[model samples]
Target: MSQAALDSLIRMAPVARKSAAEMVVEKLLELIYSGSVKAGDTLPTEQELSAALQVSRPVIREALRGLQILGVVETRQGGRCSVTDLKPSRLAAPLQFLVGLDHDNVEALYEARLTVEGELLALGAARADEAALEHLEHMVHEGHRLTTDPLAFRVMDLEFHHTLMRLAGNPFLERTAQSLYHIGAEVRRVASETPGVLTNSAREHELILEALKLRDPERARRAMHTHLASILRTTREAMQQSP
Candidate 1:
């Protein structure tokens, strides 16, 4: 971009005087939201940003770090910072920090799945293509075959949920649900370790598949609800038993 344009974009509003560093961050975010800067675009160098915003390099770097923490931009090797793809799931990067990643908060991950994924399943039941259904069927089969192996079973379980979300064709829902799935990994692993959990999960997958095959939205929703609820119960029991 031209220096003049960059300068105008980063110029602080002429109201109450906030710190230049904070204004730099606010204006930078404005550019992103305004689509003046887009995903996959490399931001101007720190020197350029510093010059444009009339802020010190230290202040510019600090602003950039805040954006990075939000998953808004990524710093590559050699100091190149680029805007990220802006996936909705990435927005939840602060959850672990804000909630504290322990047993209690980890449970939020499971609740998030149940809350978001039920809708995805209902939507997927109507929108899923033959290819998506076939892939989901394959995952169910894999889950059955891997029941004796907790790690393999868990992998299949996670992939199955991700695929289900993707099948919904709602980018925001898929992204948020995928993030929750990842965030709840520890709880999911614990649930998988519970006796008969994998077996029950595999069977539940079949029930979901059956509902999906019928193209019944309500049935699919019920099936997903049952499946997630089973795992939630198992995790709760495990937590109760823990020291």
Candidate 2:
């Protein structure tokens, strides 16, 4: 702990008779969001937080534990903890859990992705830099080569969409899409095994990539819309026949 760490605790007003553990979590989150505590900065020790926040060590302990689970912070050996990297992808863990818990959510997830990813594709087309375009081109080209290999093609499909989302330059949107991507992996795995699906996906991916390479937002958006529409239709039929 440093003098700056103490100053952060001093700046925040004390909790006013609320649940100590929950309040501690809130205050810590505030500190992180306010930039008082940053990624790679070690949090003040249990004794220090307890003394400064005027909360019991037990309450702080519980709060820290909860934070660890939420990916807000990580606890290391020897009672040390630090703020997490704060990536939106960190949220994938929770989303993965939710996805596994409910079969109905699979369709809802795909529908949500279809709605947002169309715009993301357009945005990516108009905004993706040269390096980003090249990256996407590589994936699309390699994906074509793997059309006959379902397993390899499946991995490339996810990577292609993930790269496409990141190129949209919206970290928040990219992260959300990533969560859906994780869930969709299973859905895609099943779909990829179907006859002619991979070949069609490879064709669709090339169209989507070409639109981006041409820097045509309208083309990119329409291409993605057409691609996802077909996927959704396939998903519906697959679900009906699924046990």
* TM-score attained by model 2: 0.73
Model 1 TM-score, 2 decimals: 0.79
Which digits, one per residue and each the tens of the lDDT, describe model 1 over residues 129-185? 999999999998898898889998887877888889988898788877765666546
Q: Which stretches of candidate 1 lie over 4 Å from their true place?
A: 13-24, 38-42, 51-59, 65-71, 74-78, 84-108, 241-243
TM-score, every prediction: 0.79, 0.73
Error of 1 at 163 (Å): 1.3
lDDT of each: 0.79, 0.80
Best by TM-score: 1
Q: Residues 32-72, candidate 2: write the lDDT tens digits.
A: 87777788788888998888888888898999987877788
Positional deviation of residue 177's Cα in model 2 after best superposition, in angstroms: 1.7
The C-alpha local distance difference test score for the whole of candidate 1 amounts to: 0.79
Best by lDDT: 2
